[model samples]
Target: MFSLFGLTVVPAAAAGGDFAPPGCFGERYGTLFGQGVSVNCFPGEGYGYRVIAHCANGNAFWFVVGEFVPYGFGPAVAECSGALLVPARVVAYEVDEI
Candidate 1:
């Protein structure tokens, strides 16, 4: 478990095999409610990483990862709206050549 912006970020159990090349890591966010939720990976660290948002609605989205901004909201890797009850998991990974 990790802490980001006072929010507890919990990572799922590591899958077997090496997550080589693109070093991927993930954090699971609980069900989205109200105005939805915005979460960022690797806060305050400038590292090239791609973000994959897996929604409980069986839909996934991708975001271009970029630099981090202090005292400001970073790019949201995942977002939900309307009456869609979706829990999300944000994965941050570096795309490396094989």
Candidate 2:
């Protein structure tokens, strides 16, 4: 669990399975942009992964394997767009084995 602005945020991987942060996996997957949100990436059932963006304003964005990145197995950097009042957090997941 992580904390931001005194709010405790639980990563989506807690519900799915074991997931490592982008840096932990050591590969550049892609980039994410948002505000006031938390992003959680997890391994899916098979040869893919899931990205969940939790927004403060009750908005959620789900990213699949080839949507934002080429393969979906590496590290990613999250950048805030600075357009929305509430920024969202974007997390990229990486797995050692496909």
Candidate 3:
């Protein structure tokens, strides 16, 4: 699905590629639930990478791919930038609207 701001590059199930981080190093990219969901990200230092998540409820949740932080609340929108790319990784992202 194509989002107004971001594009849905990969499916929620995730693709078999280098996008998947070896492990959640806190400094490297990691998953939100790390079990059922495909939400991925890395730890944030000066800033967090903003991303759009496709939830099972058909609602899109705004997520930050930095700070090794757990997901926060609500459906949020964020700016698209190259900085959002996980450190030492190259994974495609898929973004969409509610």
Candidate 4:
């Protein structure tokens, strides 16, 4: 039923950490959840990891793994604006290490 709308949901624990953010895993992979993920601790700048969330509305989110239950991220959903159900503030995150 939901798959028909192009959604790629996954476990939350697969994309979070508290190690030095991996260089190979810089701010580029996108945002992810951390519920069933398997993270190996390594040396990072304080705490490090990446995420890549495949959302339900054909859009995904990208952010450093944060501390929370499931420790995950869903699509960047803006309020539905217009006279329909379209998102109002359609904001997107662009990963640029600088």
Model 1: per-residue Cα lDDT over 1-98, one tens digit each? 98988999887655421132222333334444412223343433353333333323346544434233232345333343324455333343332211
lDDT of every model, 2 decimals: 0.37, 0.38, 0.30, 0.27
- Give the per-residue lDDT digits (tens) of candidate 2, residues 1-98: 98999999975546322345553333223233353222334544445432333222236554323223224555333332423455444344333323
TM-score order of candidates, best first?
A: 1, 2, 4, 3
Give the winner by lDDT: 1 or 3.
Answer: 1
List residue ranges in candidate 4 displaced over 4 A: 1-38, 48-52, 57-98
Q: Per-prediction TM-score, please?
A: 0.27, 0.27, 0.18, 0.19
Q: How does model 1 score by TM-score?
A: 0.27
Error of 3 at 68 (Å): 13
Screening candidate 1 with a backbone cut-off below 3 angstroms (N, C-alpha, C), the clashing residue pairs are none
For residue 16, give model 4's deviation from the true position in Å. Answer: 14
RMSD of 4: 13.1
Q: After superposition, which runs of candidate 2 have C-alpha atoms over 4 Å from their true positions?
A: 1-18, 21-57, 64-82, 91-98
Which stretch of 10 consecutive residues in model 4 shows the poorest summed lDDT?
Answer: 89-98
CA RMSD of all predictions: 13.2, 9.2, 14.3, 13.1
Alpha-carbon runs more than 4 Å astray in model 1 = 1-22, 34-47, 56-76, 82-98
Say which candidate scores most in lDDT. Answer: 2
List, residue by residue over 5-79, the lDDT tens digit for candidate 4.
588665445333322234332222222222112233333344333332222232533333322212222221212
